[model samples]
Target chain A: MRFQLALAACLLTGAAHAATDIDLFFPVSVQGKLANEMARLVEVFNKDHPDIHVTPVYSGSYDDTNLKTHAAIQAGKPPAVVIMSANFVREYVISDEIVQLDPLIEKDGMTEAAFMDQFWPALRLNATEDGHAYGVPFHNSTPLLYYSVDAFKDAGLDPDHAPVTWQEWIDAATKLTKHEGSTTTRWGLMMPGTYDYCGWITSGLAMSNGGEFYNTGYGGEVYYTQPSTIGAVRFLDNMVHKAKAMPEGVTDTNAVTTAFFQGRAGMMILSTGSLSFVRDNMKTPYRTAFLPRSLVNAAPIGGASLILPKGNSPERQAAAWVLIKWLTSPEIAGGWSRFTGYFAPRIAAYDLPEMKTFITAHPDAKVALDQLVYARGWFSTYNVVGVRKALEDGVQAVLSGRATPEAAMAKAQQEADALMRPYVEQTALKVPE
Target chain B: MVALTGTTERPVIRTRVRGRVRPWLTAYALLLPSALFLFGFTYWPVVQVIRCSLTVRGFRGAAHWGLQNYARLFNDRHFATAVVNNLIYAAGTIIPSLVLALLFAVALKETTRLTSVLRTLVALPMLIPLVAAASLFAFIFLPNAGLLDHYLAKIGIAETNWLGDPSLALGSIIAITVWKNCGYYMLFFLAGLAGIPQDLLDAAKIDGAGPVQRFFRITLPLLGPTLAFVLVIATLNALTQVDHIIVLTQGGPSDATAMILFYIYQQAHQNFDVGMASAATVVSVGFLFALSIVSLRSLERGIHYET
Candidate 1:
């Protein structure tokens, strides 16, 4: 009996040792159902890959995920993988807290260039640095114009033809807006003016107005006071204060979406990532279109990417690679894309039959993916969130009628410049003539 | 095991010596768990923060020397805005919260059947978490269709963007803080009132004092220490209870609701500027510490424990 018990214990220990235990940290920045879906996806991955046991840890928002991941890393208990905000990858690269996936790709019998080519071209800028992949693009988005078909039809505008230019968009919004005496019954437009989202939509507008919010290639400069940016802010201000087409002051995403669903808003500019949410919750008939532009079509790329945080043992790193590959495989990527509103970053994911069927049924998803042609890099600089908030704060003030576009943008520029000065002084200004 | 002979006592004596040493050893051994925890988690992080405040992220070594982070913060306009907003927030939340709490406490002091229900209803806000309370208020603050706007419209008031407008956002946040905190603070005042001698108020009434006069002369005078303690707590809360601000405005419509701790959190997590965050923390704690000390010293000096 003792010999039999020992043999059983030996077999149990051997089986336990065979499986690699790994933790994957993720954040629910999108919506509640997506968080549930993420947990489900992990369960499926674990079930299929019996050799590896992956535990999905729900970290908080994008910022919270970064904090928890960094803390865990510094405490010498780094997670095997993290789904970090794409914009934050730069800071992680600077801090040397993220590992490059080049060697991992090579080990998989793929070149780094070929591996990255699987993703949309726009995502490459944020995912790869110094010709090495530090992050794998999982989900990505660009801002798009969403308009209510009922509101459009009631306003004497063609529901089939969406606004394709800023002038037409303003005119459409003006007609769509309704008022009874002095009180507004329906706002013509609504956009989230909170942090992160505020900066994102503003950058998209700035880019469409033929300007860059920050240097696309550099991490130490912003052009907040430039004509394009000021013009963009003025457009937003006019919508609220001048045209009275939009609500005055800062509206968060939840409020914006609620208004859109209630028919309190005629049109809205929201992230493509919100597509799935709007589709599921919106009771009114709505249509998605390219963001109406002033000069050129543009959208700021938004979303998170799967990353391998540094300080993993070779065995753990290898296991993490396998997990990342499985998650980013076109089958899973396409499924996630359909489940969430965010478009699949992997180009081939769209070619899948299910993705095609889903896009056919939901024309909104097609508009989101089609807009990828106009999508550009998001604004990422030294002290990204702070610098982004500087502009956001100014925009919020403008929305509240506290400051004019010129003054707000100028103030925003000064604050952003001051925040980036240390980095600039260290790099750009360090050279001797 | 008891030794009766002197010869047996020597080995037993050594055992006694060992037992005596063991108590001292065991006392330290018992202390080790809590002492190590305090040192590692609390004292150590504080020391590290203080040390880090003196330096910035560097390449070669410990980096920049003294006061640079402080100097940088002094010049930043947002830092100035944060300080001014913090002060305004403290005043906005503290004064209204205390006065309302005192009013509620006075009304519900002798909790009977109706007063008990009223008190429970009033204290209901205390049960909700700060984030939930903030979220509840956020829905109420919504424009046009919101509860506040809907009710205000009935009174001939036009739609108001409670959280969206820069001018009104801080006031809205303050209202949420007051609504949540007043009920919690009211219980403390109720306890204070319960401890007060009712006979003193009766004597004042017998001496021809009016209700207001009796309240001022007997009731208010006896509640001085409680008032001082609650004031400190309320003030500290006003400075630190920022979860509502996070959920509602995110310190915006142009940094209107930004507090010192919120600003520090933004620095540490959002900006990833640990040195700046640590410096802000030290200064914030220093300012709060000084304000608390001054407040207690000035407010409690004249009070005497009567109950």
Candidate 2:
């Protein structure tokens, strides 16, 4: 009789403890190896939390992951959570594909203000859309100018003094560049110019050149035809075509890193996300500095953010929020920051003893952290991809000697304005009755 | 005419009823599984897509209803470009792949010893996974690190950016596709060649015909049916080719090589514009229908008879 009661109790508990199963889709934007790490972390999370079971779906890069997540949602198989590109958060909010996290914060007995205060202020602009938190800051990054100390010394420039202004940048590039007859032995600079990266780095350049790249408060405008953008385009044109300090056309991230590693390039502008890669790969001494200024010292903050998609069950949503809060906690965020070159979005992460030790061990990381003071939100608008492409195409043409800076920016502005017209018509251009 | 005798007519009617019932039951039994599969996977989703296209919302669920998606697609520059690119790709990939496959088959048929090894090598590309092929081709055509560019530079020629340049990007994609698909099509021609009677070729040769003349007179006429079959399949393959573009280009360098399918994928997946994507799919089906009509008409003309 006692054995029967015990068996009945066991059955009841077994039925109750099946756990709410949820899936999280993430992209390995920095390294392919991170996909395996993310999966392992999910396994640990599931093991620790008996009431929840999480599956990590290995999505592609930032862009492809966005594509797959949207496709899956359309196919009615929405993952409970996703690590999406930070710049894309605005578009998701505009489309109402992502759920607003303010209510979730309220449910946790905290105001949106208190919840957002946990993260670095610089990251909040991209994570929040129209005064509502649509995303939680995950891994964040800023563009850092990586320069070869040996090359700088060889060029008779001080290794300690990095280029501070646009003119100084150009002069340094010219001086560092080497030529054997018509063949270039070492290029002065290199950077990636693929779809997503192209738009990102260009925004950094425009921001540094004292341009508003796109409106920060609004999602319907960009100042592509402005003089600041033209200046930025001209700088690129001069580097590739005139000064011959860079490649004649766009080079991807891998090629840029390879060139830097092989000592084929004297300087390169790359994401702080590549900090770990460059540290692991470079044989020579290197230093990271803030992106050189044309009129001001500025750079764009870029990376992925954790977002909750709409249309999830209440239990799944609650489970996802728990996961998000844990993942963004100081301990986990800091560990991820050290693992990947991306700086932790949580401000408190840096206060930990381990993080302090990490910063002391890798001085290059300190430089990236310091540069964040001047960092601004990345370019995002209603038609994020279209607007960015307009500018990127213009920049590529300038790099290829196919179009002048002024001409390129003019065309780019026209195209960008055309792309943003739909949003603008609904908001800024609506006649007030 | 049949009912001069009422009794005989009754027997005939009974036989007809039995005949009809047996075949109808058999046909239904044969079609049941396939019809279920189509209903579950294809037809049901096609119906769903039609419903979704009329709705204005993100990809996930219907938030509202209108013809806004189709209207937006018509106005979208990228969508228009995608349509143009698909047409160009269909023309570029289908014709070259078919012609090259025919040439390869003809070349191998005249050779006897050790030709199997050559044929096997020709078939290797088809055996390769699409992702692997795309990745391999990406490496082979990489701007500076790729073998093609390396060789071009080594010979004092300017290295071409295969998947980067806006003008040449589509052509590079076409070339890679042709290399990947021509081999598979070659197998079809080889089988068709194997079915041809040896006597026909001998008779052509005996009737004062040389190698070229025999090939034109005897082989060409007989291969017409096979050509039509291969052409239809090749056109469909070209119309829906996505993997290579996904791997190598991701439809970039200012959207130069953006095909309709890839564009639809982007709209549905990346932009979360499923309604627009579904409408575009329906439009693509219409285009395919028109293409099938043209090819079918041509196929009818290509069919020949002999005594």
Candidate 3:
């Protein structure tokens, strides 16, 4: 009788503390250690919220995470939450595969605008659609021009003043380039020419050249063939073919980082997310600056955002919301920002004592944050990956000396239009005749 | 007496017929599990993919049954480039690797201690996973600071972009594939060489045939069956193994190394165009099926086997 009573008590306590189990799908776009950090964060959340159990899944790169999330939804096992690329949130919203966060926020007795005001304004554009919130800005980044101070000094260029315009940028690169016989010992400039990175940097250049790159309000159009965009492409073409300051053909993120670290690349344009990695690995002194401008100082935002995928139970979603809130809270957000090189999306994160101290120490990170004044939304569309690849292909062609900038941009524009034709027909072109 | 005999014979014949039917039923019952598995896992998915290829999705309106996906494939320059690239990749990887394997098998057939150590050294690359090998090679192929360029520079050679250059990218990948697979194929060739009767070689030696002559006259002909099997396997691998591509190039420097499977993957996963992906899948599988059938048939007829 005593044994049975003890068993009943144990069962009662177990039933009382039953937790809602949910999975958080995250992608490791930077170093692999970030995945471990993510798991540790989830562990802390689970400890604090005894009623929720969050399992962190290390999904692959941004593209792979998108694919996995879609596959899971189709397979009837959608993850409760996902940290997706900021640009891809638009596609998910269009396909109705993600839950809008407005209702969830309103349930907490707050207006959507008040809640969204917590994040940077530039991030707000990508996180919401048609006046409804779909994603919560977790971490955000803008492109920064990273240059080796040692190389600058070696080239006899002023290390105190980085290039502020495209012409100066080219001149600095040409001066920084080193040659031994027929071989180039050090390249002037290098940027990641692989798929997602290529499109992002290309769009940044276009925006800096006074072009919108793509229609911000619509999902079916791009300005690839516009004069501003063509000018951007021509600039990159001249870097490769005319000035011969950059390497010809495609280079991936790893190669670019490797070259930068080894001082084989005097300067490079890379995302701010790589700041921490660079700080840890680069032995030489380096500095960061805003991307060189053609007509305007502009940089495209690139990073991931926290989202709740559709097709989850109410209880699971509630549990996920708790996790997201905990993650985006100022203390945790600031900690994550310091751990990663990404500037925290929440404006309050910067006001924290720890974040302020970190910024004071890492002036390069401050340059990234300062560039936010010129930050713009990433290029998002109905089929973002396909559309982006269309432009990437053209840019790669021009870099490889295969086609002229004009011809490449025209071809890219045609391909992007064809890819978005179905969406165009359903939305913009479906007007009353 | 004759009527009694006929009745007895009729009962025996009936028993015989029943006995035959029972064994046939047992045979089918034994095959049921594997047959079900093949249909469920293999044949069913193929049928579904073919059906999916015929239906258009994510178009201007709701999906409908049509062949528009196939029509789209014809106009896709990327798909065309992938097909041509795959052909070149197959040709580039298979022939050189096969010749190398054959040479290694002949050179190392004696099984001495030195040969054993040499064989292990040759087979070392096969032991590493393709993804890991590709990553290692990525470092080795780095333009200026990489091992290859560093060594080549000492010899007065200029730096070359191994993976970044479109003209050189596919060739570099093929070289890795060849290095990875030569030893694996060599093992099969060794097995085939062992199966060849030593007396035939001894007889050729007594007849004044040189080593090369004996190899051509006896060894090459005898190794035909093994060659055919290995060829089929290499072809399948050429179509299926894309982990290296994913790691190294991702079909770029202008889609220079894009293979059929990678193209299908991009269409399905990246673009979410299921119809286009399914159509590409059907074409690739169909090509594989037809090539296998034709090669196996021709090889079976042309080759001779000793009992």
User: Which predicted model would earn the best TM-score?
Assistant: 3
Which ranges in model 1 have alpha carbons more than 4 Å from their true place?
A1-14, B1-40, B58-64
Top-lDDT candidate index? 3
lDDT tens readout by residue for model 2, B34-65: 99999999989989988888888642343788
Per-residue lDDT of model 1, residues B197-236, tens digit only:
8788888888899988977878888889999999999988
Question: Any runs in candidate 2 off by more than 4 Å, and if so which?
Answer: A1-18, A71-77, A106-109, A153-157, A179-183, B1-19, B43-80, B110-113, B274-276, B305-307
Task: Order the candidate numbers by lDDT, best to worst.
Answer: 3, 1, 2
DockQ of 2: 0.27
True contacts kept of each: 0.69, 0.15, 0.61
Chain A alone, TM-score for each of the models?
0.96, 0.95, 0.96
For model 2 chain A, where is the 10-residue window of minimal lDDT?
A31-40
For A1-433, candidate 3 gives per-residue lDDT tens digits of: 9999999999987885589999999998975379889889988898898899888998999888999999999999999999999999999988889999998999999989999999998899899888889999998899899999999999999888999999999999999989989898788999999888899999999999999998887888999999989999999999989888999988888888999999999999999998999999999999999999999999999898999999999999999999999999999999999999999999999999999999999999999999998999999998889899889889998988898999998999998999999999899888987
* Cα lDDT of model 1 by residue, A96-126, tens digit: 8899899989988999999999999999988
Model 3: lDDT of residue B282: 94
Q: What TM-score, to 2 decimals, does candidate 1 have?
A: 0.94
Winner by TM-score between candidate 2 and candidate 1:
1
